[model samples]
Target: MTTLLPNYLGGRWQTGTGAGSALHDPVSGQALVRVDATGLDLPAGFDFARRQGSAALQSMTYGARAALLVQIAQTLQKHRDAYYEIATANSGTVRNDSAVDIDGAIFTLGQYARWGAALGETRALRDGDAVKLDKDGLFQSQHLQVPRTGLALFINAFNFPAWGLWEKAAPALLSGMAVVVKPATATAWLTQRMVQDVVDAGILPPGALSVICGSAAGLLDNLQPFDVLSFTGSADTAALIRSHPAIARQSVRANIEADSLNSALLLPDAAPGTPAFDLLVREVVREMSVKSGQKCTAIRRIFVPQAVYGAAADAIATKLAKISTGNPRNEAVRMGALVSREQYQSVQQGLQALSTVTQVLYDGRAQPLIDADPAISACHAPVLLGARDADGAQAVHDLEIFGPVATLLPYRDLAHAQALAERGQGSLVASLYGDDAQMLADSARALARSHGRVHVVTPAVAQVHTGHGNVMPMSLHGGPGRAGGGAELGGLRALDFYHQRAAVQASPEVLQALGL
Candidate 1:
């Protein structure tokens, strides 16, 4: 029998009140589990975190909180294999992909733990140098970074259940705030199990961490002035979250990371046959297949010099042709299925939208799967589309097909490539491939205005480059405009989102007494 998924609230795991949404296994289209937050007490959960959990965390120094994070990391490491199993079965990802979510979560926790230690025993982080408040040296002013006296509510996407949870949770917990996580309903099993393990290990204080696996119907209704909410999903939903009356009335702080039309640019200097050219092809193919190209950071648009556009498109198609899409458990399958049938259908609709304007260079739905039935399973082949008249194809730049789909467009020059990239409004990341230092520098400067992170791939860094879609713990991951104007997980900077900054005007004697 498939077990009923429960919501972890008020320091205990409790089943929901009614029949919930059925989560499916993409490989076999089987019902994996059922979850719902029906009748769940949102106020009680928020109160527990605010009163009990927040106080416990607030009592600890930064060093002690860091120690707690390390302990939680160790506990999670012990269950890494179990976590991977849940990811594969529920998320329809291969072992390697599972590792990115499962193992990546553990790595993020460890990294934050290490970073928190470097902060020493100081609970309040100082913001910049102190300023003289008066003519006399005795009077001075400085800003202090202190933990917000409330709870953090995290609403994550389905693409990355594990890493998304930890990446957001680590800083919140480290900054001495409790967290209540709302994992996407499609793949909540992994998140539910992971949260259960942490709660079982007794690593976190009671009510410090809670998980709601199903509908967050009234979740936002319980928001208080001190609570911070972080959401990762579509822009439409983000707008609704922003419009919530409680949030606006109480002035609750919220951070959103939404969908974006990320791009990869190829410089004219890196024509066909060069190592940089080959590297761009390989990187695009990888991003197209990884997580079935469901990543928010995945490259949606490929910008290439007009002279080499045909060569680049052909090369990408050749590499994509070799990909084997099927059940992730199959060793020979290079790409896996989408998370669910609903998602697969959604991708089909998105593809139809793009097909209206661009020519389909490669259609995955027309291809055969290696070990699974494409019709029955959630598998789809990687589709590569070409926009010959890219300058006029506004749909190619405006619309986003959130699957193993990419649109290749031609640019007049390096400046044109940057202009086309910026035309996406704003992106989480934009990459340029070439060996010319001047071209890379100039293009990067222009692209930086619209992109959060610009990845410059040259022959030198091509061999060791982390690729264009990978989001690391030590680097900034958020972008402006359509990508969401909030930032997260930029090393120590991530802690700022969970902290309350206050400027203090006091005498030097008072500052010294307060340990500034």
Candidate 2:
């Protein structure tokens, strides 16, 4: 019997007349469980989070809240396997992939706790007595990060159900604001279980964490001035939500990290059989297969020097050909399926769009290698596309196939390569390979507009592995323009997504009484 996930609201369990939601295993295409989301007490939940949750969380000092975060992470670690078991249903992610999302999220929160403790009190700015202006010492200025007086609405992506929720929740909670996590409907099972574990663990006060099942139809209707909405998804949805009158009229805090055509550039010095070429080839293949290329930070674009274009293209194709695409449960399968039918269609459309700009090197459509379970874990095998004529075409810059699909674009020189890479408008990250300091610095600036995180791939640096698909807890996950300007996992900057900062001034005597 599957354990049905219950609604976590006001520190108790309850479900009303609303219809239940069904979840299925991607590998077996079998029913996992039915979640009760119908007739949820949303209004009451919101009131509790604001009137009760916010106050309870805010009453604690930053240190206390950070301690609580560590405690919740510990509890989550105890039930880690349970989360991995449940996650396999919605997305056919392999054990390692699921573990990285689940355990990595817990570690991210734990790390955030340490960061919060190091940053100290929320009231960061304090005046020493008073700075005398005109020798009177009557004036003073103060700055602090006060909790926004309402709930934080976190709408997560389906690609990473656990990590997505905790990355935003950890920072918001540490900053003394209550959170309402709304995972994508496709993978809410793990979210519900984790929330239940959090409640059972008793690490948080009532109303600190609330879970909403079903849809977010009315989530933005009555938003308050202090309310925050952070979204991670497609660009179209981001635009629609950003334009909502309530978002602007009430001045809500809205952050977005949409998928973008992120690219990687190989330096002119890199050639086939050389160290740089080896690094570049490995990166493109790894990003394409990691999480089956469902990550927002995955390398969707590849720019190589024209001198080694043929070798790079062949290398990528050979790697893709050798990959085994099937159910995650199968040890032989290296790539898993998309989340659902909708995601499969989205990935297909992206591939079609790429065909318009560049030539498909290994077409998944022409010779499809279907998954073991045709329905659940069904997605195309890894496909590589490259520009037919680099001088006459500008396709790789604008085209983005968001799956186990990659496009290779060739460039004549470093300057031309940077120009082609920058044409993507903006990206989440870009990898540059070379040992020359001057070339590396130049490429970094050229890719400045497009890349948020720039990774330097060289022979000296390739020995140790730094997780690429996963964003670091201290760095930003978002890029400019299409990449969704708002950032995630940027340490204290993540808090800025929830709080409203203002500089206040008053008389020194008055400020002294107010506590300088």
Local accuracy of candidate 2 as per-residue lDDT tens digits, 235-317: 88999989998686777888888868777788877778888788888888889887878888888778887777788888888
Model 1 local distance difference test score: 0.89
**If scored against the real structure, what TM-score would every candidate get?**
0.98, 0.92
Write the residue-wise lDDT of candidate 1 on 1-516 in tens digits.
577988889988888888888888898988888998888888988999999998899888888899999998999899988888888889999998888888888899999999989888876888887889788777899888899999999999999999999999999999999999999999999999999989989888998999998886888899998899999999899989889986778889999898799999888888899998998999999999999998999999998888887888789988898988898888998898899888889988888887778998877666778778766788878999998888888887887778899999998877677778888888899988889999889988998899889999998986688778988888899999988877999898999999999988888777766664
Please identify model 1 stretches exceeding 4 Å from their true place: none
Q: lDDT for every model?
A: 0.89, 0.77
Model 2 Cα shift for residue 373 (angstroms): 3.2
Alpha-carbon shift of residue 1 in model 2 (angstroms): 10
